[model samples]
Target: MLFVKTVTSFMAVQCVRSRVCHRKFWGWLNAVFNKVDYDRIKDVGPDRAASEWLLRCGASVRYKGFDKWQKDYNHLPTGPLEKFKIERIDATESCIMFKGFDYLDYLEHVEEIKFQRCIYIQDECLERLCRIQNLQKSLQWLEIISCGNVTDRGIISLHLLKNLRYLFLSDLPGIEEKEKTLQILIRALPNCEIKVDL
Candidate 1:
């Protein structure tokens, strides 16, 4: 019985060590993914560079004239350097943390953005996004679904996007007092169509 207990304890310790190692590895990888490549941006322009960053982080971007969403980081569409402008982004289940959001700053044609099951998007990310002047004028549609870190503060900050015509919120358990949030948003953005799901 002593030998059995010792072996079991050793096994548990090994398991814990392995899990910690695994977590550390993914954290390192995410950090790497978030690193901004300013040289790449200077060479390729904001739209193309942002596309690469989005795709690398498991997000998809649709170019202005494209019907299909570009998903593969390895097989991004090739064209003239800045010809393919990102018009919409779908960051569902993506690892797009705030550190990588600088890529989106200079994009001028982005009309829509979707954040679904994105684990790294917090209230600060929304605040930064809403403050971008380019997005403030150009973005017209926004969706946030199943992103647990987003709360009423994040939702409220989106009032800066006055051009947004449609906003969808669903499965966001972090948002308390959805009705009050909705009323505030409605008053702030009179023409916008807002939907909230509890």
Candidate 2:
């Protein structure tokens, strides 16, 4: 109990001082401690909520989790959560589905989104993603890594997000004509900053 409290206190100090723990600190603490105890980290839930609140209040940069349980609760935030980001996302075995993410209309402030190794993405899911125009307008940085099932249409829809500044799609499979897909993405998101690796 002492060890957990000490670490939790340390994390709280960092969060209160800077509003986020550095990546190295967050990673180190996860390695040093058993992160499954939700009670010890209840502050994290509020901290995450505060991050969203700060963004809605016009803070330019805000960061929140890599915590295991938080990933389990990645449903859309209750209100307009804009300009904030999820620095580390792991949706490994959670019931988190692409279909459920369509509730993303609530986030008008999310500028950057990263989905790492969330393998359930499919060609059909892209159409669903396309429906959320609010997300596309606010998104600036997007990364989809190791999503093996995403297809050409998924890449093509990147054009709908006009404000996208940097996009990174790595280790995703399906499109055979790499250059053609790149051209299509460029044409679609004419103002976006793009980099594609098949």
Candidate 3:
């Protein structure tokens, strides 16, 4: 009886240790996927390069004149840079951390972006994204759903998107003052229609 109990306890500990090691490995792998390839950006142009990053991180991108999203990184269309300008992005359940946001710097035509159930999105990521000059002018629709890392500061920082017409925020546990954030955004961008649910 003692030997059986000891073996069972040892197996349970090994299983827990294995799970922890696997989780750490996946986290490290996602960090690697979030790395920006500046050389690739130069060769493929900003939109193509950014699309590669987004798709690699389990996000999807829609081109300027297209309705279907490009989800698979391997199946990305190959052509001239002008052929693939990223217009709308849906980043659902993606691991797009702040480090990969550098790819958004040169994109000139992104209009709509949605982040849903994304674990790696936080205040720094939002702050960095909102600071992009092109995005500030071009973005019209923005949605952040079920992103627990977004606090009042990050939500308030979105006022920088001067051209944003619609903003949707829901299920964000980090947002303490939802009404205050909404009021601030409304005051800052009067033309925008803001919706918030804490």
TM-score of each: 0.96, 0.54, 0.97
Better of 1 and 2 by TM-score: 1
Task: Tell me each candidate's RMSD, in Å, in order.
Answer: 1.0, 14.7, 0.9
Q: lDDT of candidate 2 vs native?
A: 0.55
What's the lDDT for residue 75 in model 1? 92
In candidate 1, position 9 carries an lDDT of 100
Runs in model 2 lying further than 4 Å from the true structure: 1-95
Instruction: Name the regions of candidate 1 deviating beyond 4 angstroms.
Output: none
The alpha-carbon root-mean-square deviation between model 2 and the true structure, to one decimal in Å, is 14.7
Show pairs that collide, candidate 2: 82-109, 83-109, 159-189
Q: Write model 2 residue lDDT over 50-89, tens digit each, in one string.
A: 3333232222223444222232223434433332344333
TM accuracy, model 2: 0.54
Index of the highest-lDDT prediction? 3
lDDT of 3 by residue, 1-198 (tens): 999999999999999999999999999999999999999999878998899999999999999888888999999988777988999999999999999999999999999999999999999999999999999999999999999988999988998998999999999999888788888999999999888766
- What does the lDDT come to for candidate 1? 0.92
Runs in model 3 deviating more than 4 A are: none
